[model samples]
Target: MFKVLMIEDDALIGDMVKMFLKEEGFIVTRKTNGADGIEALSRFNPDLILLDWVLPDMDGLSVCREIRRVSQVPIMIVSMKNKVAERVDALVAGADDFMSKPFSMHELIARANALIRRSKLSIGTDADFNAPTLSVSAIAAAPVSAMKPAASVEVPAEEKIRLDVNTRSMRVHGKHVDTTYSEFEIMKCFVNHPGRVYSREDLLQTVRGIDSFVTERAIDVHIANLRKKIEDNPKEPKWIRTVWGVGYKFIPM
Candidate 1:
């Protein structure tokens, strides 16, 4: 059974959500504050987290960042804050999905299931990626090079980038590059389809899946951050180039 750690302040809402999830065969541990919820990280080691934006001690964004420091567990922000900027803040703070208050229980369950499934597929035990699921056709011709044994491959300096599906790591110019989960996903998509233009919406769906809550503008933030890590000059990126009013595309070396 999938374990869910829910951090919600309202007792009535917490009970309702827990009961609903339990009915769906999910094992849920509900906490009324951010501190206890954060502690559950090691104690419960849940498969997913359903976090409330308003907490007794700290805002949900801080809690989200703290959890992200140690775990990549899928987080769904359950908040009454429905504004676009608030949703964008949650995504930027490392949340994988978001749902406003007074939401449909059925929709919440569906989104929860989707998040868990996607997380499992992303970090599957297999040594190589299931490229078809990721729509990685451009790199399909060179699967060996793109998904090589994590430890054995030593990419030459001339090679601008390399990906290790097992480690979820990226190396640019033969140097290990540190990237957030979203940034890495975006980069993976770009590398897979070199030279293909991707609108912000396309890139947003790539990282957050179909149940994404953030706007397309959030993709711009992710792309800018990615350029900083991978490009020699983020201001005038060489690989991730903008296509004027349309969107962005990757120019593989």
Candidate 2:
């Protein structure tokens, strides 16, 4: 189920919206103030956020800024301020979208779902990405290699990380890029969807089967290993930069 963090001070509205969203198939966490909403991040790890502009303790814009500092989770500002300037300000403060007050519960749910869907795909944009899914049955049948190995074959090299899926071998910068099975598949995903961000959850789901119990840290470890091989300066990675508070994205030249 998709998780949502809502920061709304209006008790009646907050309660009603939370109940409505729950009915729409979301695990909702409601916070009355910005500070509590900020603290909820560690606990909730929401896929999307619905922030009210005015909060009892602090402005919601600060919450947006703070969340954006560490994560690229989708944020939508729901406010009484209907001006274009207010919407632009919210976006400038790192919100992905905006909704004026007096919104339908159904519309709110639809927008929340849309944001979560977009966040999973990359971050802000919403282009349909058919990220290949690994089946649990396939995982159980095969070793944890993530991909089956095959005999080597000759092929022309691309200007980027070239993966010969049949053999599952890879090449980068005209040289054979040595990689383990998991690393090769990860690279294949990145190269296939260059410029798209993949959160740890995303990488975990795509690289491993959705039903797999792999921890998020395992994704980080694998990424570190891959960066060491691919980046000239892993500390200052060029090809795969960390989108703080987000995940990783392949930067194509």
Judging by TM-score against the true structure, name the best candidate. Answer: 1
Candidate 1: the clashing residue pairs are none
- Candidate 1 lDDT tens digits, 135-188: 233353465346432334334446657776545667776687756567778887
Q: After superposition, how far is residue 71 of candidate 2 from its true place, in Å?
A: 0.9
* lDDT (tens digit, per residue) of candidate 2 on 148-240: 333332333335455554334556666766554345557766765667788988886664432222456656766887888778888888988
TM-score of 1: 0.81
Indicate the worst ten consecutive residues by lDDT in candidate 1.
129-138
lDDT of each: 0.79, 0.69
Most lDDT-accurate candidate: 1
The TM-scores, one per candidate, come to 0.81, 0.51
Model 2, C-alpha of 53: deviation from truth (Å): 0.4
